[model samples]
Target: MTGGERRPVASRLAIRFAIILALALLPAGVIAFIKTDALESEVEARNEAALMGATVQAAMAETGLIRRVRGMVASLSHLTPTVINDPAACSELMRGVAEEEPTASLVAFVPVSGVMTCSSAGRTYAFSGNPLFEKVVRLREPGFVVNPRGPVSGTSVLGISHPVLGAAGDFMGYVVVSLSHNALNELRLDTFDSTHGSTAAPVEFWTFDRDGTLLTSNLDLAAAAKRVPASRPLAEFVGTGSTVVQDTSRDGQKMSYAIVPIVPGDLYLMSAFRRELTDVGGGLSAYMPTLLMWLIGLVAAGLAAEFLVTRHVRTLNRAIVSFARGDRRLQAIDLDNAPVELQELASAYTAMTESITRSEAELEDSVHQKEVLLREVHHRVKNNLQLISSIMNIQLRSAESAEAKTLLRNLQERIMSLATVHRGLYQTSGLADVRARELIPDILRQITSISSGPEKPFVTETDIDDLRLVPDQAIPLSLLLAEALTNAMKHAGATRDRPGKLRVRLKRSGGSEAILQVSNSRPDVSMRARIPASSTGIGTQLIMAFVQQLGGRTDSGEDDAEYHMRVTFPVSPLVTAENRERNEASSDKLGNDPV
Candidate 1:
């Protein structure tokens, strides 16, 4: 009848909820995993393709650079001898050429007689010990040569040898086009700005000749040429057509390159460009759209799952609430129209309710039969105890000696206390338990009535209402309180010489314990100390045994010439509710006060 009671329909709903959650989450998790793997693979393939394409673009750019440098040298040869020989006039002319083509490292003229001169910067020298220079001087006509250390004093330049003819058409000397091949470094795309204005990762460029001269580079030209892995065959690559060479550095792996037969006859133009294929947009902003899409998808999927789960929960909740309110006729909503597992749940619920009504009727009939049997047993026990108490009272009155009469009287009290509890239980709804608060007062009133306390003003006070304790707690509690009260009445009497008041109080302590306090205005010090000049009292022994059996504690003290006896014990609602209720009802019938 309490709110905490569970129904059969609730169990069915729990099963339904578990099934629905599994159905929703399992499929979503599988789909998400598959999508994640697919996206990662696609991105990797795209990255690889982009890198390879960038490498090919870099190689073609190098070949174009070499051709452009060759054209610049050809146009310079048309000047007259006066302009070529005059240092001041030639310096101005070569300076103009240097400004026009910034990639040209140097522009100078070399004579067939081995005199080397820088026509732009105005430094002059002759090739003496250099083997590359000797090779250039022996050539009789226009040719280009790789001179590691040429007729120029310090820097190495690619020598373009052409015959300088006199008026008679005889070769006077060879006019040489000495161009610093280091200018090939300008082809490096690493220095170029990207559209995003972010500089790309730095890359180095270096071109080395057969004699270990760095012909061109964005790095330290001379130092980088010396550091080239000497094992790589630079001469073989130049003898061949345009070649792509792969190399590596601390920054990244790269392609070293050369465009061979660069200027005909003796010259080869080697151009090196670092091939750095990296993401142009290396930041989160580059993938914002993709991340945004993923986040949107995640939120949408979560909301969809929540909507589906909440919808099913609402359907199940309605069924549970109806069952809790005892509406057995209410039908559960079908979830099969909702989700996969919820649909299965609906089928299960329908099947369960189909049989619940019949099962509930059978259970109710069984409970009613058991209750009838219990009530009959309680009625029989009450009758037998009453008969025994009556026989004890009759026997006590017939006893001849004073000691025998006292023993019989004590025996009668004990028997009557137990019978009183049984009598209360027989009248209660559930006969398994007696309410002690009701039983104790009835036993006391019966004792007081025969003991001449009709006008003694015996007061009964209780702080508990509707709380029940089982037969185990109620029986001992009833007998104990009855004995304590009986002693109080016998000693604190309104006899011819003395009169006193009796107080009986029962309450729940801290909502966890049952307490009974009986105080009487009996002033006899000998009785208070229980140190009689006589034999042991039955009241003391009986009260001690009852307290011990009930797992309770007893305290006795005197206040204002009144003897107070208190008994406190634990109560378990699970074991005691029915009996405590019945006994309290009987106590109400027997007492002058209500609590």
Candidate 2:
């Protein structure tokens, strides 16, 4: 497998075990989550109850204060007209009523003309445009109204009015009691302190009139207003019974509000408590125990796999890797203490390695025998060719005519060239191909020895690159080189005036081709001119035949002061036994085909 595709055995086993563990514990996790949700609901319910209780307690305190105010107003309504028409006596009576109720800011009697005639502050006031007077006059009923600034008290107040009637039951005027907003807020705080104590969560309370006019709050009026939900106005909760609702406040804090009526349609106490219970973040904590257990189980599984299985598998892997790296010496895998399956696998691997080693040894021996036989055949052939050359040399020495002697010597040189090829084959380690670097120099030495003499010595230069050729091409190439060298040496004769020079080069031309060049210095141009221009001679014909056998082309010409011969050919690929067998099979099939 590629490196990216491979994973550690321990990690893979750990992941699988983790999946199994999760499935096994799925029900328990679900149960814990359900329990957590139920617990959250219980907390929210309890908080709601506490909030409502606190609101109702504060509302009761407010209701008691309003009732006291009404009682005081009722007592004043029975006042004798003799004292009521006297402004000083009426003011004295109202001041005594205010003293009796510490929270009352004003006790006033306004006549039917909507003007206050008697007051606790002993001030006359016009109430014609006052909403409290207008409502009391029109409805002629007991009612409540909130004024930011009362004309009599000169402070924020809640006006509680009770309509009065004459002896004839005709509308006379109204007795209105104004309670200070700050005093009412202090009364509510006293109730909250007694009921909740210091340990209770902070709560804000706002009292609203039936007309939605904010009268008093335990906190700052503006801040307490922000505690109320923007979607629900205070008037919406005025006539409703005690209720609890969950909503976000204007300041974006989640809150639970308890709306409890002090007087069903006149006043409401709205207590806003921050939703600490419902806001509990329990999602992760609910699953933490299960997740922690899963992690522990996964780690244990990974360790177990590493210790019990992967360690043994890694040992086996090391042995296999060593064998593949060509270490023939067999190394034993110690897996006896491993699991039964792993032991059996190791046994099978050992047996397979043993078989492979034996096969390799036998194959090596067979290859050695084949190489020896091939060398013997080439050696015998070379000996026979040398014997034939020896015979031709003796014939040349005893020839009767000059032409016959020249023909015999040329034939001897050709036979000796074949011997040189066989000698290179037998001496080389590889029997299938010849090394041009070693063989070409040997062949050139043999040709020079036979053709050159001490009196007519020619300087020869050779540049050859190491190349390999099969026997099919090597034999013809050797003969071609021999003929070309012999012809060049004959024409390039050394004299006292100028020495003859012969240059030969063989090298790779491009990617898959080779070039062979042989050039000689032309000291006497007249002598080369005397030679026949037509290439119909034995040497020329033999060179052409060798070039054709090698599947190449040749070029020959005189350039400047030298005669040059160049041969270019494609290098044939080395053929292995498999390729040779395939080629033979194809040839047989083609031969059997109908023309």
TM-score for each of the candidates: 0.44, 0.60
lDDT of 2 by residue, 24-88 (tens): 77787778767767876775566567677777675667667877886777777777344767888
Over all chains combined, what TM-score does candidate 1 have?
Answer: 0.44
Off by over 4 Å in 1: 1-309, 324-326, 330-332, 350-361, 392-405, 429-436, 453-467, 496-498, 524-536, 575-595
| Total clashing pairs in model 2 | 0
lDDT of 1: 0.60
lDDT of 2 at 325: 78
Instruction: Provide the global lDDT of candidate 2 against the true structure.
Output: 0.78
Each prediction's whole-model lDDT (CA) = 0.60, 0.78
Return the lDDT, model 1, position 106. Answer: 57
Across 180-259, the per-residue lDDT of candidate 1 in tens digits comes to 54454445566433222464434444444444344555455554564343446455554565444445432343534424
